[model samples]
Target chain A: MLKSINVPRHDRVPSLIPDTQASMTRQEIANNNWEEALTFVALQRDRSAYAELFSYFAPRLKAFGMKMFGNEQQALEMVQDTMLNVWKKAALFDASRGCASTWIFTIARNVRFDMLRKKQSRKDDVSADDLWLNGEYPEQEADTDASQWDTQLLMEKLAPHFASLPPAQREVMERVYLQEKSHQEVSDELAIPLGTVKSRIRLALDRLREALDGARN
Target chain B: MAHAIKFHPGMSLLEQHAEGSLSADVALAVAAHIDLCPHCQQLSRDITADLACQLTQQPVKTNTTDWQHMLNDIMAQPQLSKQAAATQAQLSAQAAEPIIVNQREFVVPRALQRLAANHGKWLHLGGIATAKLPAGNDYHVSLLYISKDTEVPQHTHLGLEMTLVLAGKIVDENGEYKAGDLLINSPDDTHTPRTMADEDCLCLSVLSAPLKFKKGLTRLLNPLQQFFY
Candidate 1:
């Protein structure tokens, strides 16, 4: 089931990529083909591709877990569980349907959901995968007509609009998505009202949507 | 005949659902609604894709933990073959059991299938029946069936009350609800929910607290609450 990959690991070291969106040159952004890397891991069982993915995602996931769980041990556990799922569920990834980051993010989110359920000792009859990963309804899958948006182009177009948002809106966006904080938690953390937090998020989404839709038109 | 779905979860709720930040019990209602409503499904997909776009752009803090060892350990584990994954998907699809109520069969959304399979025995009172689906502790999740022309007593919620219509039609003071309509009621809202004279109804109900029946006999209110809870 596995074949060796010829791609060299040194050609795509994730560590060399800069941290900020502004600092990332076009070459770096263009080279970020996590979707293709995942295909290699799936079809070729390419350890080098997997390692490159790990280098790019693990620290970010660690930061994500720390923000969500507020401890190092649980964060590390999350990284391990998420990465393991990435390896095991690689065959399920479809590049045409979605990007690698979104697919990986969903896996990470489901891992966190399961961990939360286990910590609460809740009955495991219904799982996050059942609720999130499966088709919303069995018949609905047959009628799915559109492929996902071209993610690389969307990302490139969205970065400037995202950066230009008001500081409060940008901060709320980061806390909600990156930190995975609930709106209520963000309200409490930022010392703002819940309504304010919600409105800011709404406005931020509107601006980003307009930017993308503009490009499409 | 299928009725066009009119009521849907608000955009904020849809966004929260895509983020996986909503509690499981609440998220179940949204997911099931998305099953029946194509509009929300598309909106949810867009929101999730946008989230992915934003998430990828977030700056990462450098951490020095030995993720190398963790990666090596993960690499050592056996990857699931495509055949095995396909088999699992097939098993789940085949395992979906139709929910039966009052000699009538109702097909629930995929999200509720597993928990609905293990639901408790139906408890009947008057023309209404409810069966508890074991899910979260803080909320009461159940399948509620109301026979034709039956009217539930007027009640106000103490916390949150979310109802997702699965089959047939129901009408309240506000408007008519057909299949795939999700009604979210907070503490301040009070209304009587009833079925049409010619149609029966089935709903997925989630309650944060027991109902407080209004405008009923003082001695009979507790039993009325018990009927639904």
Candidate 2:
């Protein structure tokens, strides 16, 4: 017999994003073209636009790293590495290929991967970027729609849909994606079977996929 | 491209890849598979977009002074010119020459090209060849080549084994796998994989643990295990 456990309501609540702040952020995000900000930083070496991006992404990246590292100092280091890469590789950011948020998220993910490998003393000839962000693959020719990759718009539409998910499903999603825990780790932590964790994840993904497609259509 | 890919990494694996939660070596197999399977490529992009939305939504505890300090340092760094970036990409592309084994040259997936270029010398056995790639400590990553009309000894996995076909076809007891197909075998699975009589095959294999040959001569088993691991 499996025992039921109470899941913490951390970070996945719809009420956390109050409507007033959501509207304000939406207006600000609409007026500001993050893609253009990246372009300006690339072409003209614009410091203001760079600063704007830093103010927006740094805190979130710090939060992202915190789950992986569990230490504020190491999390800060991840933020530094990721932001520096964004600055140096700004010219490589192609808006047609992906949105600004997706691009930065890739950079952050790669940096964190490298950091973990380094800590493990795993000397790998294949870098994280080589695996995750290969350049030789054919350009994703289909679905070049700009709106599909818009981060802020998706976030706005996704907030309530994500919040409406059952608490059990939401807990699995947070553990797997936000906390960077593997399915096996989630299973062990929750005292559930491995198959159960995978099923919950699949079901949660199904619901989120439906919600996203509904919003898209 | 001769046959439609019949196998792929599971949905949970793809989701883990998008989350960047899977270990580097396991994620490599998924990345290479996605390079050939456009359907999965699209799925990966959608998942990534969703991940980005969720990630950026976390309410951050802002330390204004610290953020300002880091921002100043990052802003002071010089940015790469578009031309320089393009040149860098071109140079890396040029470096990834085709992989050659047993008098055959096979173009591996884009995700595998860089690491494959650095693969160790190919070691030959009866009708198979294996070249080790630099990978994480927990997994043994290599390029496995099967010559025409060859059969690997029957074995059961001690742990997970992931194989992605880069050229030609392979058949086990369960099914036939063609190029772009990803085969995942757990410890419970036991089978003998072989190549066709006239067609050779090449694969990217990531093994979490060594294979335990079940049906071969006991004396040959140790060497065979040594050969693979």
Candidate 3:
């Protein structure tokens, strides 16, 4: 029924990491500022530190891509591009609002969303705020939005800018967009336990809401 | 900000910007999203910061692109006339072209680069290359390349080995894994693996020790030294 290798030890995250929960735990994340991390890494050119972050993130991004597109090539490409962007824009990581993982995922989410939009023949510039708020509504219903007086101002009011988001959270957003797929499909595609996907999506959405409200007020 | 909500695309735009991979216009769209949704906006900033931190660590030595070689290649291009261009277009019309391998980044992502930098050199087998990495004193990290149509001998093992199919597909006791399939092996498991006839198999694997042969002739070669590469 299944192929098996010898009884060697194995792990989910590479054995290199100590205290894996430091990333999982929100308090730990609070202590670990992504902006500060990026700045420190940038100043030192510390390869090991970079490798640690990559080890933690790349596989998840790969997993996300695989689930989103169901194509290995595209998945690898997505992770590659995501990492490359991280390299080019390390100077931009800000620790004040969120953690590192959330930021990276948003990037993956945005990339896949664009792929879907190209096929959908939609106009440019969808905001995260709109996606969260407006995505719940059927397309035609949101058409006559009351705040349509000044389209530009409405857009500004509706959309908030994001630089990067972690892979897990991004996967949640991508599930609904490009795949034109359901949340369950997203879980199946990523091979993650379905509940994990739901939780992450809610978590990501909550963070997005907070960010928007903060930006507004 | 159009007729449809188009929620996830906004997310995708964020991903593109975070990765620094989006075309200019697509980026503008996500920027607008961030302008409205701070939740994603904040998340985007954090992840971007993390990625940036990781990038800052990459040694700058390689940042010096091989421009000279690139320019030389460009200069060395065989300039074909406009007539050749027409001929090329005609050839494309006649036959289906092959898919291209797209690897734009010079260094593989940090997550994957560890597969190389931290692990051992690639060991080349018959068209199929294999490498064993030192995960620990007992554990091993392996990279396997099974060439098209090649049949691996049925073998059992004393330890557990887990394989994550990275590229291509191979069939054995288990089902087919195109990519992103995590196949875990326990002790006493055995099987003969054959690569999909068309493409070679590339697998990133973790193993504990040398495999113990269960079936036949492939066991004989265990003692004799094979190609180092």
Between candidates 2 and 3, the one scoring higher on TM-score is 2
Query: Can you list each candidate's DockQ?
Result: 0.20, 0.20, 0.02
Question: For residues B9-76, could you state the per-residue lDDT of candidate 1 as single tens digits?
Answer: 77678878887888888988888888888766756765665565555556777556877667767776
- All candidates in order of TM-score, best leading: 1, 2, 3
Output candidate 2 Cα RMSD: 13.5
Candidate 3: deviation at residue A47, Å? Answer: 28
The sequence of per-residue lDDT tens digits that candidate 1 reaches over residues A16-99 is 323445334422422357778899988877777787777777877887788778999998898899888888878878776666
Interface RMSD, all models, one decimal each? 8.1, 12.4, 20.3
Residues A65-134, candidate 3, lDDT per residue (tens digit)? 7666898677666666665545444444554434455556655665565554554454422322222211
- Report the C-alpha displacement of residue A126, candidate 1, in angstroms: 3.1
The predicted structure with the larger DockQ, 1 or 3, is 1
Chain A: TM-score in each candidate?
0.53, 0.53, 0.42
| RMSD each, Å | 9.9, 13.5, 23.5
Score candidate 1 by DockQ: 0.20
